[model samples]
Target chain A: MSSHSTRRGVASVMTSSTYRPASAAEARFLAEYDASAYATPLVTVDPVIVTLRDEQLAVLLVKREEHPFLGSWGLPGGFIDIRNDADPEACAVRKLKEKAAFVSPYLEQVKTVGGRERDPRGWSLTVLFFALIAEDDVPPIDKRLAKWFPLSALPDAMAFDHRALIDCAIRRIRAKAEYTALPAHLLPQRFTLSKMQRVFELVLQRRLTAGAFRRRIEPLVEPIADCFETASHRPAQVYRLRPDSGSLIFEQPLKGARRK
Target chain B: MSSHSTRRGVASVMTSSTYRPASAAEARFLAEYDASAYATPLVTVDPVIVTLRDEQLAVLLVKREEHPFLGSWGLPGGFIDIRNDADPEACAVRKLKEKAAFVSPYLEQVKTVGGRERDPRGWSLTVLFFALIAEDDVPPIDKRLAKWFPLSALPDAMAFDHRALIDCAIRRIRAKAEYTALPAHLLPQRFTLSKMQRVFELVLQRRLTAGAFRRRIEPLVEPIADCFETASHRPAQVYRLRPDSGSLIFEQPLKGARRK
Candidate 1:
C-alpha cells in the first residue's frame, strides 16, 4: 500500500520548519493577545428533553420571543451563566430549571454545534445536551409558549439550529439504547414489562417481537414483587433494572451474519 | 419522587421573572460586550494518535518549548485557526500534518473537554480528537521535539490537561472496540488474522481466544489471496475487511450474563 515508512523521533518532528516553536517576540504577541480583536461567539447551552407522550416520542420546545425566528418553537434552553455554573452540564441543568421549570432524571452532553450561520445574533456556539424524563414525571408547561412536539413530525422552522440538535439527540438515544440502560430513564420507578416494551418501541421507532425482546433483556432486568393489574387485563409482572447492571450492551450480530 | 407538576407553556416561562429574555436595551448591551469584560478562555484542539509499536500501545506527544511545562511532553496540538479551518476536526488534521508529517487513516471527533483553569494561559476550552494509524504508515518526524511514549507508562509531566485527555481517548477507544469494528482502523489495508488480533488485544488490554475471535470476525472480514510463509512457521492466511461491513456492532452480552 501507499504508506510512509519513516520512523523519525519526536525531536525531528518538533524542530521542523512547519512545527517550530514561537519566537520570543511571537510568544509575547500571543501572551499579550487581545481576545477582543475579533468578535467572540457567545456560548450557550441547549437541551432536548425527550419523553413518551400519548404513546408517541416527544420533545419539549419553547417559543423564541426575540428576532431571528421569533415566535418559532425551539428546544428549551438559554445562555449559560458562566459565573454561576461550573461546566456545560451544570449550565444545562440550571437552564432547564429556569426556563422549563423541569428536571430530567437522565442528562448527558450529546455534542457541540457551531458555525454554518446557526444564529443571526452574530457568531454563536451552543453546547447541546439530551435529557430523558418519564412521561408521568413531565410537569405542565409553566409558560403558554412551551409545548411538546412529536419527534417524527417537527415544525417547519425552529429557532437557530435547534432542529439539528433534536435530531442528533434522537439518533444518539436510539444508538445508546441498543447497548446502554438509557431506556430505563424514560420509564417510571415502577413499570410493567408491557409498558416498558411500548416505551422501547416508541424510542426506537420500530416494533419488536415481545418474545425476542424478553429473551434479549432477561438478564438485564429483575422482576420486582409488585405487579400491575388492569380492569380488562390480567396481572402483569413488574420489573426494575438490576441494581448491579450498569450499561449492559447486548451485541446482536450483523444481518448478513444471521444466516450462519 | 419529588417532581414538578406545573403545566405552564413557553410564554409563561419566558415572561417569568426567572427566565426573562434580553430586552432591547439589554440586547444592545450584550452586543457591545467586550471580551475583556470577563476572562474569555482560549479555545484549542488536541489530537491523540494511537498506534501499536513493538507489541505495546503508544501515543504521539511533543515537548513544549514555552514556559508552562517547558521540556515536558504533551499531545501535539495548537490553538485553532478558526478562520482557515471550518471546524475543530479540520484543525486537528491540519495540526497533525504540521506537527508530525503524519496522516491517519481514521479520525473521529471523540469529545470536547473544557474547564475554567484547564490552561495556564487563562481560562481555556479544548476540543479533543483521537486518530488511529498503522505502525508501518508512521512518517519520520520532521522536528526533534516529537516522540512516541508507551500509553501504560507516560512521562510524569505533561502540559495542561494533556494526561487526562489521553486517558479519555483510551477509554473511548477501548469501549468502542467492544461493540464497533473500530480496530480495523489500526491495521494496514492487508493484514493477517494474527496481526489483526494483536491490534485488538493491545487496544482492549485483554487477550482474546483465537477461535472465539475468528468466529466473531468471520463475517466481518473476507479472506484474501495473499499469505505469509516462513521456514520456521507455516503459511498464515491474510484477510481484509469487507466493504459492506461499515461499523458492524456485534452484541456480546455482559459478563454477568455469560455464565448463564
Candidate 2:
C-alpha cells in the first residue's frame, strides 16, 4: 500500500481535497458556529505502537488500501465499535491485535487529534493510544498487510493524515522517554546498563556519555541478581525496573544535557 | 444531552426503547472484526486549557449540548480547519479563540487519541492540545456556554468521552508541573515563591513543605528585579522563567528524583 520511497516524502505533497478553501464569510461563520446547530461528537483511536529492534526505536505501520491518498503507510488503527466496547482503550487494544497480531506491554491515552480537514472524509475526531513493546517480542508479521518502520525512517507515502500523526508521536515518545518508565518496555524483562543506554540513545537520536547516562537512570534501576555476557570487553550487569518507581522515569533534562 | 448521572448508569436502567442492546453474536462479531474495514481517515483536535484562579488550578470547560451525554462538562475544543491554518498549533489556537474567546499562553500537542468508539457519531479521530494560561489573564467569556472548573474539583458528568480525555490531560499537566516550567503558566508573568509553590501544590494535588518546595524549584527560578508586597509578613521575592532554559527544564530533576 505504501510507495517505494518513505511516507514523510509523500505526506509533504498530499493536499486534503475535502477541505474547501474558507472564504471570509465561512471563516466568520465557523468562528460563530451556532452551538445549537451541530453537536454530533465523533470518536476514533490512533495507536503509537513503539518497538525497539536492532537497537533502534520503531513504530508499527500499515499500508493503506483505500483512496484519499491510498497506498500509504500509517499507524494501524480504526474507529471504535461504540455498540460493543465501553471505553476507547478496549477498542484500541482490539484494533492492535487485529491489525498487527501484537499486544502492548504498556498502553496509555496519548492525546486527541481533531482537525476539520485532517480527514478528507468528514469531521473525524481521534483518540491516540501510546503502546510500548519489546522489539524481539513483536509477534509474527501479518504479511497479509502491516509492517514496522524505524522512527528515524518511515515509508515515503502515508495515507490520510498519518504522516503528521507519526511525526507528533515520535516527538512525544522521545520527550516521554526522558521522564517516564516507558523506556523499560523497550528492553527485555532483564537487561544490562549498556543495553538500556542503547534504547535511550535510539529514542533520543543522540549518544550520551556512559557516566552521565548511568547517573540519570541509576535511581530507576534495581540490579538483578544475574549478569548478561555481551561481546563487549566486560560482562554487563543486569537490572530490572525498580518496583516502587512510577511510570515515567525522566523529564526533559536541562538544555545542555539534551544537546546532541 | 447529559443527565445528572453517569452514562453507564443511565444506559443500564434506560428502557430498550431509549437504548437498544445488540445481540451477543453481533457484539462478538464487532469485537473480532478486522478494524481496517472502516478506516476513513479524519483529523480532529482536543484542547487541554488550564488556568489558575482563586488559588486553584482549573481548566476551561463547556457543557455538551447534544445527546450521547448532553449537558455534561468537557474541555472546549473542535475540528481544526486545515484550509485556514497549515500548522496544528495554529488550528488549536483558532479553536480556543472561536469557542472560548481566549488565547493560550502555552500551547503544545500533548498526544493524539484515536479509538473507534471514542465517538458515537462515526469514525472520527482527535489530536489533543494542551495549554496553560494564568487564570487572571482569561478573557471575558463572550460565549456564555463555556465555564472554567478547578482541576481538583472536576464536574461529575462530562460530555462525550471527555472525562477520560480530561483525566489524561490532568495527569500530564500534574506530572509536567513537578519537574518543568509548566507551573509558571499558572502564575503571573512575575510572581513570588509562595505563589509559585501554590501553583505546584494545586497541580500536583500534594502538599510540599515550604522548605522542600523552594529547594526543588530554586534552580528553575531566577530572582527578578521586583518583589510583591503583601499586607502581612515580609515582602516576597518574585521570579521569572529563565528565557534560555527552553521547553525541557523538568527532565533532569524528575530523572534524578526517585519516588519513595
Which digits, one per residue and each the tens of the lDDT, describe model 2 over residues B1-260? 22112222222122112211134543444234321223232345678887777777677887655443455677667654433444457766776776677765568776665533455433345667777787667777656878888777888756556778877877888777666767777777777887777777777777667766666677767887756657559877778777675773543452222346
Query: Per-residue lDDT tens digits of candidate 1, residues A1-260?
Result: 10111113212221112222235654564455443333333467788988887887899888866554567888877664434555667777777776667765467878766552565443346778888888888877767757789877899977777888998988998988766657778898777777877777777767767776776677778888756556446878788888876766654411111222
Evaluate chain B of model 1: give its TM-score: 0.79
- Model 1 bad stretches (over 4 Å): A1-41, A251-260, B1-40, B226-232, B251-260
Worst 10 residues of 2 chain B by lDDT: B12-21
Residue A11, candidate 1: how far off, in angstroms?
37
DockQ of each: 0.10, 0.10
- Top-TM-score candidate index: 1
iRMSD, per candidate, in listed order: 15.8, 19.0
Can you write out model 2's per-residue Cα lDDT over A110-166, one digit (the tens) per residue? 656654455543344667777778866777878767888876688776665677887
- For every candidate, C-alpha RMSD to the true structure in Å: 12.1, 13.1
**Residue A223 shift from truth in candidate 1, angstroms:** 1.7
lDDT of 2 at A163: 76
